[model samples]
Target: MELHEYVRLDGVGLAELIRTRQVTPPEVESVAREALKIADERLNGLTRPSFPNALDAAGDGPFAGVPFLLKDVPIAAGVPFTLGSRAIPDIAAAHDTELMTRFRRAGLVALGITTMCELGLSFATESARYGPTRNPYDPARGVGGSSGGAAALVAAGAVPLAHANDGAGSIRVPASCCGLVGLKPGRGRIPCGPDTGEAAFGLLYEFAVTRSVRDAAHLLDAVHGPAAGDKYLVAPPLRPYAEELDAPHPRLRIALTTDAWSGVPVDPEVAAATARTGRLLERLGHTVEVATPALDWEDVLAGIRGEVVAGVAPLLSAPRQPPPEALEAVSRAAMSEVRAFTALDLLRTFDAHNRVSRAVGTFFADYDLLVTPTLGQLPAPHGTLDYDNPRYSVDSWLRRLFAYGPFTAVFNISGQPAVSLPLGRSASGLPIGVQVVAGSGREDQLIRIAAALEPDFATAADRQGTLDQ
Candidate 1:
């Protein structure tokens, strides 16, 4: 296959071709390398390319010939783990994390590491460690982070799928910013590691961002499970995720909300996109009603901040010193601000989590899904959220981050499943993702609704263009 043709195929299609011996693994790797050459010159998405691994893994499972990329934060055996900061240099992983082991077992060839924010504390993908990752539709704009780099590569056709994890909106925000599909599985859907335990407040979930819904589905099937010693596990799906794509869901009652939880004005383009998506869902035979669930924005934000601070405090208190340039201003500021929270304050935050989780759970009991814009606006300019600006207070910086992604954090807090679908585009031609969220362990419903409504908003043709030029 030619590089252009390879770039056009989704992960599932590429895997099938490889399985049938229609496309040799070496041929796929060659095209992937060529695609990366184009992507590096344009998207600034990769921190380091793993061309040698791609060559070695070719002809290796169902996806033996398929090339893949990992987010910079995860420790993939033998791949450079930068964590999107100069603080951590190019240290190769000595052994694969459980997630990477699954990727290798599934026959995915590691082609490179994608960029992200330092410590994943930011909403935009501009790292002092590796400059900025540009959106393919418009190079001047930001690709959402800390999975920003992975999303850019997939959206730009550099790769059909790439590893991405959502702590706050890392995966979905980028999927929204670039035109792609990002699914944040319910808690414990994909194992993190035996040493790490669960993520902050059990809010962070690991999954991939892909160009097609089925690709996301298939990848989940390949990687979903609890590594022994995990804190908890999400309930297994009724059927395999890939098989669920073809099964029709009952007509769902979806609640749509355009009011930004922060009470800030969403960009008109974003509002329009949400409205358009609501219409699409209606056309697909689902009933759509505009409703705002009772949610305390301040309490939710405070709980998220508290969890993040408390979770990272131990790492921050360690005796080892960070290189001056390794830590960015935002992360440093975050570390400083979090120190003020007393043990009582952390308890209060946990109290807030239980309260919010129960409240959101009650709302989902009445509605099948809640649909909203993944972000309040179209992709912002690169570096707008960069940590170089010292004038911004920690509170002010966090406010800005929430404004970029208000809808996603709620699911994280509630430990529910959510997905961002590339169902619309901004007036300026950038991709606009519609977030579909379901109750905890109800990812099946979210996937069904997304697959049902995907065809109405945009077609595959909308994704093709001069991503590199």
Candidate 2:
């Protein structure tokens, strides 16, 4: 098959092609690697030393021979795990985590890694250690963080889908920027691990950014169940996630809001795109209403700050540690701020989380979904969230980061399922994503709605070839 032909197929589509012997795994791998090479040359969206023998390394299962990439976090083992940091360079992971084992069981070919922000500390993927992951839409703009490279590589048509995890909107931000389907499954919806469970205070989710909702749902079916003794696990869905996409949900009651949670006015363009989507939802027979439930934005931001800083502290201070300057300036400053935190501080953060979660739960009782801009604005310029810029102190940088992605952290805080759909674009043609959030553990609702709504605005992968120019 031609490169464009292979690249356009979603993960499930490719697997079907391979299963029927219409195309071999080796043939698919060749086309994908060439696409990744082009993405690297044009978008700077992937890491170097690509793993050429990934198809051979991958285990067999339902989606066997499908190519995928792991973000440069501690998601899997036995590969070069950088954690996107300068402090821990060139260290191979020792063991496969539950997510990794699940990936193998589900038949995903792990074809190397992608770039991300150091320690996933910022929304932008401009890592001081590895450089910026540029948006495929326009190389001058950022793809948005920790998951930036995954979003960019997929958007550039390198892969139909790639692994992505969200903490404070990491998946959705980049998905919005790159015009992909980015879903942050509710806390406990996917496995966290044997070494540790309920990571990032139960606010993080492991999933993927994909070119189509069906791809996202199919991968969810393959990897969404719990592992034995997992500290956190939700009940398995009654049916497969891909099946949920076809299940009817035309009567969803969606609440729309331009509120960014942080109360900063959303950019007019982003707000407008969200409104357009609201109208689309209403036209589809779902009732859409403009509303914002009463909640403390202060508590939300505090929940984000406390979890991330505490999580980042140990990773930097571990195993003899690196010199302070070896770390990014903002990371250093964040460490300083968190050093004063007491055990009570951690408890209080969780308490606030519980309170806010219940508050959102009550609101959801009246609505099936909450609609908002996945981001408060369109994609940022290259280095906009770069932590090394001497101009931004830790405080200023935090302010700017939330301003860019105020909509996503609230769902993370509430432990609710959310997906960002590439359903709108700015007048200048950059993609914008609209967020659809459901109450905790309600990914079924998210999948059903996303599959129903994505057809109108989701870009076809074949058009992504233009990104190379």
TM-score of each: 0.95, 0.96
For TM-score, the strongest prediction is 2
lDDT, residue 262, model 2: 70
lDDT of each: 0.80, 0.81
| Residue 142's lDDT in candidate 2 | 87
- Deviation (Å) of 85 in candidate 1: 1.0
Which run of 10 residues does model 2 get worst, by summed lDDT?
A: 460-469
Q: Return the clash pairs for model 1, or none.
A: 87-326
Candidate 2 is scored at a TM of 0.96
Q: Which TM-score value belongs to model 1?
A: 0.95
Q: Cα lDDT of model 1 overall?
A: 0.80
Q: In terms of lDDT, which candidate is strongest? A: 2
